[model samples]
Target: MKNNRNRQVVLKSRPADIPQAHDFEIVESDVPDLLDGQILVQNVFLSVEPAMRGWVSNVANYSEPVRIGEVMRSFAAGEVLQSSHSDFKPGDKVMGMFGWQEFAVVGPAAVTRKVQEDDLPLSLSLGVTGLNGITAYFGLLDIGRPRPGDTVVVSTAAGAVGSAAGQIAKLSGCRTVGIAGGSAKVAQCRELFGYDEAYDYKSDNLDLALGKACPRGIDLYFDNTGGVISDTVLRHLAVGARVVICGTASFPTWDPWPNGPRAERHLLVKRARMEGFVIFDYASRYEEAVSRLSQWIRDGRLRYSEDIQNGIECAPAAIAGLYRGENTGKRLIRIR
Candidate 1:
């Protein structure tokens, strides 16, 4: 074994709201021997997403919650160190739900996909070419169904998924408007992601800003944060508009069930549609999305950013940082 000891961050306690470092504890253990059908992977990068909050929360979600004392659930990029499965072999690069650990012994089913883009950075597997890119590609194109010249607005515009969604919308010849937390992110939306118009939801009067940005009303709304921002966007939906609910970062908890303005009236008045999709539902088409996104990257039609922090110790804090809007793009912890 390259290293006998494996370090991991486990969920120490469930957080009432935003996760804190105290909610997790780092522990070290001996690397286990791989069993039949199992692969031993040494993680290179650990991804942190806003959805993680729900994973550890007691609330009922699409997936099962991570129990206390378990390795915090996470998607990671890593290399296969040893494999007992015929489908996998040593030296293979892979991405999967390897959790917040330096090393993981998981069955082949846990391996989401084999990393094949040697020309691309392995870290990109956990970001642009991985979950973020795939989510944006399917959510925007399939769910949002953006049309050319459509006014498409995205919340969390500078984030990993949101940035990709906005850029993809632009590629579809839609006019894109972005809503971000601060001026810097707003600027990143307009300058970095090529959003035609960008607004700071934290500072700008969102209702009026949406009015100015989408005078023709929003033909498509890629909503990552659900709260007042989404409520405002719902009010401005163009006739037959499409809304994709990708995340709800604004809500601290769902146990109490946070309430907001009803969207039924807006949908009724505009004949619009709103829907949510889990990335796992589109797993069969993951490689397709990755291939197309990679091509876009090569053609210079797409761009993405990473807010990488070194070491597994940063794993706990990284989740909280995302909710604080501290990350500039995809938040990752370098395990090596």
Candidate 2:
């Protein structure tokens, strides 16, 4: 067995704005023994997402906030070291809310699913093949309801979820345009993700760029950033256009409620539909999305990127970096 000592990152303080390293504290403790229906997992990789800021903040969100002095909540990929449950045994690979810890003792509820794609890397269970890809799959297909020959525009188009959604739209026979930050990510949106057109949201005249790229208007808008980018896309909606609000990465604080242009006028004029998408709503159908996503990877119809940082200590800093648009793909922390 590995050493009994477990190192964990816990919430030290809630950030006033973007989460910083000072917001978390790393502490060492003894790994607890597993009880009946519990499994001991040795965490290998930890996910760093923009949503994590909400998880740690005092602000209300869809999920309960991670309490102070508790291990910071996170999705982690790891191997079961021991199991008191019949369904899981030693050496079984799994992914779940294992928190920001070196070792986790959890029940079945905390275990999202057993990692079954043996040919794929375990780290992927936290990235493309996991929530990121699944979110894109259902949000675009089910919510956006993309049709052939439609013009789809994706905000944060080079991001983990955005990239997947864009490629999936292309696979559905829609013309895809990507909006990302910086020249590199715009280039990545075009070259790597195969977007028909990509614009740097920072440098380009967004209104004119969107007008030119989506000449016929946007049939589907997979919105990951819900600020100015979305404000711009809403103006370009085609008749009956569908908008999927996946994330609001641009908002530093939702406390005072940052003011923005209302979208009702645009939706009403175009008779469009805009709906929020939460991945947890489709938890029952995760396998369905994963199965198709896996096949897409096998068929070369899908591709993904990962920005992996070494060491569990990097987990806290990674969240802040993600909001800064520092990562090109799914950002993960490899526990060393």
**Clashes per candidate (backbone, < 3 Å):** 0, 0
Give the backbone clash total of model 2: 0
The Cα error of candidate 2 at residue 86, in Å, is 0.4
lDDT of 1 at 175: 97
Q: Model 2, range 237-324, lDDT digits (tens) per residue?
A: 9999999999998899999999989999999999999999789999999999999998899898999899999998798788889988
lDDT of each: 0.92, 0.92
Candidate 2 regions exceeding 4 Å error are 1-3
In candidate 2, what residue range of length 10 has the lowest lDDT sum? 1-10
Name the regions of candidate 1 deviating beyond 4 angstroms.
Answer: none
RMSD of 1: 1.0
Error of 1 at 72 (Å): 0.7
